[model samples]
Target: MRRAPTQKRSRDRVENILKAACELISASGSDTMKMGELAEKAGVSIGSLYQYFPDKASIIHALAERYNEESQHCLDEALADVTTQSGLIAAFDQLIDTYYDLFLAEPVICDIWTGTQADKTLRDMELEVSRANAQSLVRTILRLRDNDGDGATFAARCLLIMYTGEATMRLAISVPASEGREIISSYKRMMGRELSEMLQV
Candidate 1:
């Protein structure tokens, strides 16, 4: 027997609802999103919204998944050939350059990407993405030194913190790209010096 056509329409409507939610979330902060507005933007009924998502958190969770997929693709491409120490450092710098450029290209979307969820479910999803990024970075650091898992992990976390802080700072202060490059270069130099010391120990 064939399934009901209404079922297919229901799924399509859910997808449309989520898409509209993401667009609205990008324009305004996630906290500012309204259900009525989302229904109007998606051309769906509030009842239909309940049929798909229990609350705004579900829609936001879906958006998080969408953001993660896009970010994973970009990061994969950025780190695809980082096999050597120098290549890893170059990739690290290039990753920062590429990521900052991407984020600056869409500040609103970047804000959406940076959005957080208060619930544990949403936090868990983001945590998985964070852990995956840390693991990838740690692997790259390992190529620079062996038998130092603890140091590699520490380096990855430190670099991630530094990179994220610098990106946000540059955005907040509207720092020029040339100056930002210098700042990032200095960070790379410091990281190299730290790694040298770690290796010597």
Candidate 2:
């Protein structure tokens, strides 16, 4: 953004702009998104929109940041009560389901996934968010399994699971709902089995 919104009204305007942009990108592909249309949908002046975001990429980046924040909050909540092995499995299931639902509910997420890949800054931001989430998962795992060896190795494994889950989810999101559910279920089973074995080792 050119300047961060300081006042409440300015912040609200920025939020509206981002919301409108998300809706537009969800309905129509991001390649065709127009600043004028975004401003009109947001019920804000074009100048006001420009005052916050200079271009469409910036708007998408802000939306991506919003998604990351929401996802992190969901992860925290899902993992909060995890202690036993069963609890960990349940937490992982909940996390996967939550993300699947989120991806299906927000079409703009598809845009964020595909659109931000080429942008190094956006990709770095996403990676940082993912790493933070992985760190949280690592802490939970270490707390539950006090004897587990090498915290860094365990954390890397956790990161791998997250990356694989995201890849599966990306593919699942494009398929039919029934097929997607099956794909996710298969993933959960595989991940659960692997985790069970890992905990035993």
Candidate 3:
């Protein structure tokens, strides 16, 4: 945002603007959404919209950040109960399935993720989210058994797992429903096998 919305009303207005942007993006995508269109949809003046978001990219950034935070919450929740090998596998599958559902529920997020490809800040933010998730995975593994002798290697594998999950989820969203389910099932089985192995010394 160009300026933070500090007051209650200001904050609400910004949220309304972002909500409007999300609707517009979901309908036609970010490439075609205009500021005037968003301002009208948000029931705010173009000037007010600009006050919070300097441009369309800023609005997408805000949306992406919001979605990323929500995803982190999902990751935290899904991994919270991970203990034994079966529990960890279940948690991992649950995390992937939950995010897959979230993406299907919120179509705008797919556009926001695609938008991240061209923007460095958004890309960096995405990497941070992955790293944080990997840390959670690493913590779970530490309580289990030594998958790799070094923490760094274990964390690196966790990061790769996160990246693979992310890719599969995105791909799953783009394919037909049946194909998507199969993709998710296959990935879950693979990850489950890997995670189950990690639990053993």
Root-mean-square deviation (CA) per prediction: 5.5, 1.8, 1.9
Clashing residue pair totals per candidate (backbone < 3 A) = 0, 0, 0
Off by over 4 Å in 1: 1-11, 113-125, 143-201
Cα lDDT of model 1 by residue, 111-140, tens digit: 544554446775576567766665656655
Give one digit per residue, the lDDT tens place, for model 2 in 111-152.
777655688988788778878888887887777778666788
Poorly placed runs, candidate 3 (over 4 Å): 146-149
Window of ten residues with lowest summed lDDT in model 1: 164-173
The residue-level lDDT of candidate 1 at 56 comes to: 76
Higher-ranked by TM-score: 2 or 3: 3
lDDT of 3 by residue, 1-201 (tens): 899988999999998998898899889989999999999999999999999899998988899889888888878887777667788888788778878887888879888775666899987888888899989888888777745446787788888888778778778888998999999999999888767766677
Best by TM-score: 3
> What Cα-based lDDT does every candidate model obtain?
0.63, 0.83, 0.84
In model 2, state the lDDT of residue 35. 93
Decide which is better by lDDT, 1 or 3: 3
Which one is best on lDDT?
3
How far off is residue 49 in model 2, in Å? Answer: 1.5
